[model samples]
Target: MDASSAGEGFTVALASGETVTTRQILLATGMVDELPETVGVRERWGTGVHHCPYCHGWELRDGHIGILAPGGEPFAELRVTLLRGWSSNLTLLTDGSASLDRPARQRLEALGARIDERRLRAYEDGPDGGYRVCFEDGEELPVAGLFVAPSQHQRSGLAETLGCGLDTAEPNPAPFVVIDSTSGETTVSGVYAAGDLTGPAQSVILAAAGGARAAYFMNHALAAADAQAALTAAGLPAGSDGD
Candidate 1:
């Protein structure tokens, strides 16, 4: 079965070009943000342009920073406010997006970060080997680092096709496979999910823990099946028969 897409189902492209079927599938495909068409943004993704502050903030601490805004979705202002801790020379660019709320506005002001109302046209290499963000209004800003909140799209389309639901009540409503916190069991029998596909805020340690938990459950499940078959072959009850 060619269940390459993310989400919680199987896609089988038959070799004879006829038909295919799948019983259970787990969509563990993660999400990715498509960067803006800006020139330097793509090239500097890991070096200077970044998204997750927790992942890339520490390295750029105390450096001049710029944040591109007008995000498609609503996130807590705390996201940018938190970045203020990393650099006092931070600037927020409002590339023609909605206005911030009063409280958010006050917080941004208190952080000593300047807000750029002009639209961002492109970015290029700066003289200092940093970045030069050009505005549509022909103004330019130089910064040692840049951050932008790009819209997130699920990498797994198979999960959505199979109707795997997401935890919409929480923030971010992209479809995700349901799993037992302890066993990693999905709604569909025998399917499991782990890592970033489950939800955000997962670190390497957390992902490793999730994988371990799933493996532990799978091992026990296989052991139980083996014991059942052994007892059945011996002409005994498959489960505990008051032994």
Candidate 2:
């Protein structure tokens, strides 16, 4: 699908070879999660593998948990620290991707978490339950669950094509479309955004809330614009209330 600015509004060219116009656009395009190259990670996503601590931590509480800290992820240390609260039997699998600083090591040691720097081979269902962590050096570890921080990106390039600004600041490993915090309005006046496309937190509840808010604002904008158009057509001066 192709989207572009058309006069005061926007136009969308659908894949079915139909062109559609709109007065305003709400972009709930969402995001794409890019997981690691491990064999079983993709197949086991959601069912066995997860990314958020708050979302999946409670279920695996007090059980053996392994966190895959891929190389060059700036938030690796932070993820390890956060996961420690949910399970005392925590292991940091670096997969030979990163070196821990002295302070970072001390922090993990303080949390009584074990560090496993072996390269990962695959993930599999254990004989009993949970996941089997396979290493390249011919070893395996069993964990109740596994956590991974996958890189995220916009699912559709229409946001960028529509000239919406992106938030490229730190702490956000990936860039998200910039939107007004209150209204979810994008840099483009008639364009708005919500959900994973606007922020890093991937919670469904937050996405729903953002969409609701953007819709509220969009409704007001649309109503006012329609009223103004009607008044102008009647040869009357439009007031603040569009009367």
Candidate 3:
């Protein structure tokens, strides 16, 4: 289906070519993981490559783990720190770019996590579907699981079609859709966004929370507007402007 649009009201084009117009639009398209172009990374993504350390850390605990992120891009140190709880052998691979700040580097090293700043040559899958991270220096790290924070974008192009503004956090320079802190309204009037597409607190729980918050405010607005319209239709004063 085509995305919603802005004008007198929100218009969303359906797959059958019909259009549904409404007073408000909620852009809950979510976010998509922009995986690195590492050869094995794409092939072994769901199996061994993961972005959230908490998601697959426990399963690969006590084994080698690698934190892979794009080179030259600023990433969160907290990510590496969190994985330390899962495994004693953790390597933060910069993948060839000089992104880690000295303090962040110090913190990770202090946590007993090795910092591997070598350029990633490629990711080779093991017979068991695990990975072997090959670096330019010909060093190979046998890892059971790899944690990476790849760039992310709105899952669908619908948000852009709606003409909404976006915001981005560190490590990723791309902007995502912007929304109100309380009501979750978008930069565009009558349009709103929530979930990962709006901010970085990602998870099923957080996504549901954002959805409920946006729904509450949207319902309130619709109720008030519809009530006023009904009063006017019935030839009533509609409570007058100043009331």
Candidate 4:
């Protein structure tokens, strides 16, 4: 599918030779998480490997949990701290990526979390329905679950094609779509956005709330536009007159 500007509205072209036109557009396109290319990771993503602690922490509580601290993760230290709450037996797998400083190493140790800098080789099934992490150094660690800090990106490129700006801030694995906090309006007027594509709060409840808020403002904007069109068609001033 392809979309572009068409006069005062926008036009969307579908692959099946269909087109849609609208005066306003709300982009609820979400994000995509890119995991490491380690063996056995891709196949067991949602079932065994996860990215969010709040979403999956309770299920794996009090068990041996491993945090796969991949390189370039902006909040590596913070992630370890959060996951430690869910499982006292926590291990931070550096995978030959994290080089912890003295203080950082000491902090993790204080939290009773072990730091493993071994290069990860692959993952195999453990005896108890868990995962066995194999290292290149011939060492293995078994855990009930593994939390990965994945690099994320927009699921669709249509937003950029339509000239929506992105927020380039630290700690965000990927740049998110920039929108007016009060109105959910994108940098491009008449175009709006909501949900995970807008910010770091990637929860179902928050995404739904965002969509509702954007829809409220979108309805008002469309109503105003229609009123102006009616006035112009009747050969009257655009400004409101006594009704």
Give the TM-scores of the predictions, in the order they appear. 0.79, 0.93, 0.80, 0.89
Q: Show pairs that collide, candidate 3.
A: 72-97, 166-176, 167-176
Instruction: Give each model's clash number.
Output: 5, 0, 3, 0
Ranking by lDDT: 2, 4, 3, 1
lDDT of candidate 2 at residue 141, scale 0 to 100: 96
Write candidate 4's Cα lDDT for 1-243 as tens digits. 777889998999878999999898999989999888889888889878988888899989999988888652446677777888888998888788676778878887897878888899997778878988899999899889888888789998988999999987986778899999988999999899999999877889889999999999998888877888899899988885322
**lDDT on C-alpha atoms for all candidate structures:** 0.69, 0.87, 0.78, 0.85
- The TM-score, computed over Cα atoms with residue i paired to residue i, of candidate 2 is 0.93
Model 3 C-alpha lDDT versus the unseen true structure = 0.78
Error of 4 at 91 (Å): 0.4
Candidate 3 local lDDT, 1-243, one digit each (tens): 676555668777888999888888887887778888876888888688887765677788888888886663455466677788888888877777556678867777898878777888898876575678998889888889888777776788877787888666553445678888998998888888888888766778888898999999888777777778899899986664321
lDDT of 1 by residue, 1-243 (tens): 234323433455655675544433434566776776766688888787888788888977898888876632254255567788888888787766646776776777787877777777887788867778888888888888888776666676655555555565556544456678888766655566777777665467777777778777766766776798898899988775231
Worst 10 residues of 1 by lDDT: 1-10
Q: Compute the lDDT of residue 53 as modeled in candidate 3.
A: 68
User: Residue 181: error of model 3 in Å?
Assistant: 2.6
Better of 1 and 2 by lDDT: 2
Candidate 2 residue pairs in clash (backbone atoms < 3 Å): none
Residue 22 in candidate 2, Cα distance off native in Å: 0.7
Q: Which ranges in model 3 have alpha carbons more than 4 Å from their true place?
A: 1-8, 97-104, 127-130, 136-139, 168-173, 235-243
lDDT of 4 at 7: 96
Clash list (residue pairs), candidate 1: 6-156, 6-159, 7-27, 7-159, 8-159
